[model samples]
Target: MEIIFLDQNKWIELAQVHSGRIKGGPIAQLFPRLVAAVREGRVLFPLSVANIMETAKRNDDVSRRLIAETQAMLSLGYVHRSRAARIEVELRAAIQRRFGIEPERMPTHWAIAPGFMQAFEPMDELMASPGELARVRRMTSLVDPAALYLNYMVTQDDTRRREANAKLSEGLSALVAQIEGRRARFASESLDMRRRIYAAQSWVDHLDVLNRIVAALGYSFDDLSALGDSTMRALLEDVPTMNVEVEMATRLEAKTGTLSANDVLDMQSFYTAIPYSDRVIAEKAAISHAQQAKLDSKYGVILSRSLEDLSGHYVS
Candidate 1:
């Protein structure tokens, strides 16, 4: 099946079509075909953590429910792992590739579970009696539409939403402040200099992923510290998602537009979707950013803003 990552806005548009609020549009035209493709097992729309978080933080319950229902039906609750988890997976493979060793393969199946897997919180496992566990397992179904809806609906709870959104607001404020601060600091640097600096800084920024990768490799920090600058750059280039993230950041950071949380979320979405998904249908800005980095060509992904363009594929 073709893996397509739809941008949150596109998903909303499709949601409108599904809700019959939109009578005519590219998304409306494409809706039934897309659904048939999904039902036929010819195409799969995988949800990103961005999709879940963005939808959750919306203030409109009707709109949220509309989107939640639409996504639950189409996505069947498939979602990419959290950002750290995704990078850790890619970093591990990048290490193996550097050493010319065949790494453990990626998960062959799209992630499927209840919609809670799409949430930002970590799931706590519970101990259950063997017979009870068996009974619950038999009853558990990832494909249950209501379960997925309820998963997203949890975020709509007033107290929880306020708590979650407060943190998100703080993050957004800090991100914007950080960018403006960096822009002022780099005011006199040449474009080339800034790009180079950002590329190097990108590696340092993902220290968490690097830490996990080192531990998994059974190596101490000092053991790999001597790999040298050039060697590190080469390994990062081989790491598809990191390469995409850094390249996109360099271009974006060079620009003068006021940065927002949406931009960071787009980067998060692209970092995962551009490298892994066969087709990435995202917003115009994100698509342009990835294209500017030549990510689509390098990664062999069909990156487009037009859902109507999807007409040619997955017709079963």
Candidate 2:
């Protein structure tokens, strides 16, 4: 759609009227007539036209009077609410792209420059000067006359608008590249951590096997410090098949009222094997620690390790 740029002086006039200095019936009566001229396409300048109409609507005394004047000026033809609405939609999308969020959704008042940035690329220097551009970026609400005037000013300069558009395009591209890089890094780290977790799991399973052997033997490990290192290695090697033999020996010993060599082996295995619960708790703590490390790396803040510590306590 073709857009007519408004003159800067017209904007200044609208701004003055908005400031409430132009008082009384004559100015109020002239307001509606001026609006009708633009609405009828007799006068053109998109920004000025919108501003004049908006200003009139805001002034209660002027607005009611203009309604009568506007009705008398023409047949009241179809108002271009849809066109205005479309502009508003485009403006909002542009603002979102520039700010990385929807302008209307922001906590602060919005302005036209940010909306323009979303709509067009900004000049490199202008883009770099966030403080200056911020004045324009926060034009979310149309209620502010300053925001409306800024929008009018931006529309008047094709060169500035083009520069702004280019800057925004460059900024968005850079932002996307940065996000993708971070995502790739995270995925790589996650896979590596998964491998470590599996290795830890294997260690735990081995520990559980040793515990089962010890339980079957029904031997106390309290006095195992006397056993030689070679004897301990032999007990560890026999953990897999020791359960049934250990149980049988325990029964035989109960019947005969005497402990055997096989039962002693079982007791040794039990002492060396890690408990399944202990393994699980350790694995969980490791995962929790890894997660906190990742978060700290990403956000530059250390998260509480309390949850991981708590999980370990429960599992152990």
Candidate 3:
């Protein structure tokens, strides 16, 4: 079955509509089609650890049912330790090629113990010195920041957890404000036109580099974008995978700016989908990050916001 990964917002939209919190909107129309598609085995809606955490944040019955329903329909998948190691290796090469920044030594995947596997946190440059940032950068690139942060918070000494939490909170606040500010600006009719023009230009510049990298990886540019579920899965199985999300966050750090804890977690959700799903259905911010990283084209995955768009694109 074709895999379709939904962002947390889409799940919440479906849940709220189901509970009659809102009536007769596009989500109402979209939700049923998604359910039918999943039920008929036309697609697979694989949940991730990120989905579980995001849904668990809300205590309402609607959110509870949504989580349970998703779990029932599909098993939750995570970034396996082995896969993460491969991603880290490729990530280093991509960074060197694209940015000319080379690490002194290859970063090791954070899979020392069973429990440490698949855990990661965003590299908070603000909290580190230049030397420290370089090391932290490699470590963060290998694992999910949310997982790493959470593991650090719970398992570390009290003094360390306190420090990490403080940094996490500060980073999250800054990122949240940044996204909110962007939302407010883009919401304005006067600014919307200029915002779209700027965003379009950013995509054009980023995609050129990304497309070149994918081509260097021996994937045909045209064939890569047109891959179907089975073909895409086979291709990924045959190649080394890079953490496109982290690479995007790293490269676009100057353009897209620093990320918050929530932003990192949101990213981890899409990153998890890279290996486990055929397409990633997400919000503008998430989609933009992937596009900026050129992951959609590079990895041959469909990234779209509209459920209708996906429906038309993924007809079985």
Candidate 4:
């Protein structure tokens, strides 16, 4: 029986019907129908096959079933390794021509469609580069080498940024420790000398440490920012911060007012404005209230607020 492309509703009905009966059909049964449909040029089954493969990955059972079905189909035809290799060479040449670089120099697999590979063969002259050979090897394990190379480049760039941030974190930790150690030593001096000698030294050490951390962070931020605003924003928003570090940094900045306007802008821009706007405004208001409470408790500076006053101001 010839299969036809079903409309959305018919497709949904077919899915419901086949969902139970085809629990684990032989691979040959599933794809041959589709492949035959493609061979006849009646429908575009390649896209359907690709879509099924992607969908299968989301569930193990589906993936296993799909793999079994595909395997059964592939077993029907004898795939020529030499033909595949020649096709790989053709693809490598195409890549080199497009990018001005050999595929093997790329860090990821370059895969091509079986049909495309079978249709083209590489000339011997195009097979001269070692990089091209290496690319062919990598592509053997991948679906598409060019796509894989692009993904690899993105991953490598992120990894480089993460390594830079890690180095900066280590530097900040050492500086913080050094400043704390200096403060402890200065505190151990005689009481009279402690107040006179350590007063300025203590504040200076604390400020210096904060300044260095902020400066290091700024440099890291600048490097990521150069990549793109979105990447920079994601890095800052998703960066892991220890509770102790966050609290300490906040207290230090509160005392020293060392966090500049630029730093605030960097952080504000990093967060998503839509969902975070109200939350951020509320948090800022809470901080203001907390500061007012501290003043009232310590300095007898009582402040009052009414429902009318609260409603009068927009959070933004």
CA lDDT scores, all candidates in order: 0.72, 0.32, 0.52, 0.31
Residue pairs in clash, model 4: 27-69, 109-145, 110-144, 110-145, 111-143, 111-144, 111-145
Instruction: Report the C-alpha displacement of residue 199, candidate 2, in angstroms.
Output: 28
| RMSD in order of candidates | 4.1, 32.7, 13.1, 23.3
Please report how far candidate 1 places residue 168 from its true position, in Å: 1.0
Task: Please give each candidate's TM-score.
Answer: 0.85, 0.18, 0.48, 0.19
Q: Could you tell me the TM-score of candidate 3?
A: 0.48
Off by over 4 Å in 4: 1-156, 189-312
Q: Considering TM-score, which of the candidate structures 2 and 3 is the better prediction for this target?
A: 3
- For candidate 1, write residues 1-316 as lDDT tens digits: 7788988988888889988999886677788988888888787787777887788887888888888877876777666645554555677777766555688875564232334453232430122356644543454453464454556565456788879888987987797688778877897887668767776787788877677677777776565566666767787777766788777766667777788888878887888677778889888878887888788889899998878888776555
Best by lDDT: 1
Regions of model 2 farther than 4 Å from truth: 1-150, 189-316
In candidate 4, what residue range of length 10 has the lowest lDDT sum? 270-279
Model 2 CA lDDT for position 144:
41
Candidate that scores best on TM-score: 1
Over 46-120, each residue of candidate 4 has an lDDT whose tens digit, in order, gives: 112212222222324443343333322322211112222333343333323333344455311111132212212
Q: Is candidate 2 or candidate 3 better by lDDT?
A: 3
Predicted candidate 3, C-alpha RMSD: 13.1
The global Cα lDDT (0 to 1) of model 2 is 0.32
